[model samples]
Target: MNRYPTVLTIAGSDSGGGAGIQADLKTIAALGAYGTSAITALTAQNTQGVRAIHPVPPAFLQEQLEAVFEDITVDAVKIGMVNTVEVARVIADMLDRFKPGFVVFDPVMVSTSGSKLIQDETVAVLWQELFPRVDLITPNLDEAEILIGGQIRTPATMKGAAIQMVEKGCRAVLLKGGHLVGSTIYDVLAQSSQEPLILESDYIESRNVHGTGCTLSSAIATYVARGNSLAESIIFAKEYIAGAIRSGADVVTGYGPGPLNHSFSPVSMQIVS
Candidate 1:
């Protein structure tokens, strides 16, 4: 029997099941990887907005990480929504210790409703410690603006921000341009020593895009686990997310924004012979 490549997600839990660990796991499974999780926090959230948030203890978080790392063969990791500086630090420490093969950091500092998820103090910790440890960091335009302490309004600015993130020790940066106002959505993937690649998609007009960032990052991590190159991973992940968005557009899950169709089809895990 062949063992499937395993992907782990360390993220907050979204009660609505649209974003956070729920979305990450869904995307991972949909992309044909075994999904595991170490939840950082729990939020009372829905399509409308976040109602309340309760962070898990750092010690418990560590335990979760250790438990998963000790037993499961984690092929890749997708980290999201470390809500505090200590949580971020803990995750960074674990990453340093274990050094998972492929790590995707979805720097989830804000919600789709434009509310801050992580605190200001944690931002420095994330930049100093967590930023350098991961294989790829996926930050949307708003999160990128917060990271670089400046505005990112254009494609040039996005590329500059990605380069700045690369300089900050991130191996590569996938700066998402979904929030930008336009018909064409451009996602810039910039590596440390390579020429940056631009992935432009015809913007799918839809309201059901709540968990796009989480889904995209998780899908990319799954591809990486399955032995795809970073560029190839991003390309395939982009196509998958586009299809998800297109498929889930008319399905109403909530009064506000809904989630993408992560499991439109059961994608079999691709194992190298």
Candidate 2:
């Protein structure tokens, strides 16, 4: 029997359609997977900045999760921007209950402007209840610093932070070095049992990178859902996002940082047995 390799994105909603649930769904679909969602919050924002956020109640979030998992065979899961501790707990419970095949968590703790998004309590809950359950935790430099309480200034420091996060309970860590200074970017992938793998790319100088993190993580889940190994999935996701960025670099969507061209070269929906 064949069915679409389904990926469920549990995250917030971005009215800008560049990040959170919007980006996740777009990335998943672009990578040839069936996309499902369980929205955790709603944000009013554009390429410039976020103005407000409306969180979904924890119970309602649980209902959303159940509605999808009860019927669909979610081949993978991508989690982003869980603002409240209660919402984090609800998502943690669902993951425990469903035990999905693959879980990629993008710890969206800091904003583009360097403001903290999740509370300290919510961060604690993520570490205690969710980190162990996720297969990979993708944290940009800012989020990684918050998680580990240190600075990541170079690829070497990024490696150290990724290892520290793995030691703190994460099954694996992908510490993004996009925020680091340079034309070349480094993303370090680390686990307790294996040496860290440093993935590098020539950073594209573009303001249209509002949803790169969300897109990368969701693409990772989509590839894994399509039967790629975790390492292979990360590599493929890196290539996909690069193309998306380059494809949309010149197109202006808003006054500030625009979004990637997610459908630059989308694949057909993939089938798996």
Candidate 3:
């Protein structure tokens, strides 16, 4: 039997092939996992912006979930771009059933190009039905602002908001500080029982950052599936993304912010006991 840690991505598809299911699968494979997918939406988008989004029917979405879990021993899950409340609730029910080994939720609310990806009603349902199920959530600054109803312009505010996500029932929160203006970026990982862990890195100047959130969360899930501790997974994922950004700094793929070079490197898959 294949012993590689398996990761399933539940997210949208980007026609641009940079930010959604594409990035998740690339990151999962790069991190050395068997990557599966249950696509939640399809966006007609490019590096410039999202032109349109078509959500998979709720029933079909359920079937996709069932098909993956029924056949694969999913070691971890990475969730992203659930665009409706119905989809959100369906995912919750499925999670309760399968109880995957680990779950990383990237609560994608908006696209990098200023497009709304989820409904306003779905926001509340995420806090209610989805928040408690996630092992960790990787939300960018705007997402954190919406979740906490306050501006998170500084590292201090990021810490407070990370705690708020923990209070709301997320097992952990990776509040991304990429959107904040700074010479250094900070991501706070906060959990219910443990003290918060703050990760800092110098910002690498690059416009090719289209699917960073999706990529980071997928890398984390893949690492966790490999049986690495959460802290270690985050650290490793951070290093991977930083290297990706630095490597792709001078390259250009589109007129606007381009996609990361997710296939720049690949690691051997972990054989988990």
Model 1 spans with C-alpha error above 4 angstroms: 269-273
Cα distance off (Å), candidate 1, residue 203: 0.5
Candidate 3 local lDDT, 1-273, one digit each (tens): 547789999999999989999999999988889999998998999999999999999899999999999998998999999999999999999999999989999999999989999998999999999989888899999998888899888888889889988987788899999988779999898999888878899998998999999999999999888889989999999999999888888888979899888878888877766
Global Cα RMSD, each model:
1.2, 0.9, 1.1
Q: How many residue pairs clash in each candidate?
A: 0, 0, 0
On residues 157-248, what C-alpha lDDT tens digit does candidate 1 reach at each position? 89888988898888999999998899999889999788887789999989999989999999999999888998889999999998999999
- Candidate of highest TM-score: 2
Candidate 2 lDDT over residue span 1-273, tens digit each: 889999999998889999899999999888899999999988888888888888899999999999999999999999999889999999988988989989999988776745456878898888899999999999998888888889889899898889999988999999999988888999999988999999999989898999899999999999999999999999999999999999999999989889999999989997877
lDDT on C-alpha atoms for all candidate structures: 0.91, 0.91, 0.91
lDDT for residue 249 in candidate 1, whole number 0-100: 89
Scored by Cα lDDT, where does model 2 land?
Answer: 0.91
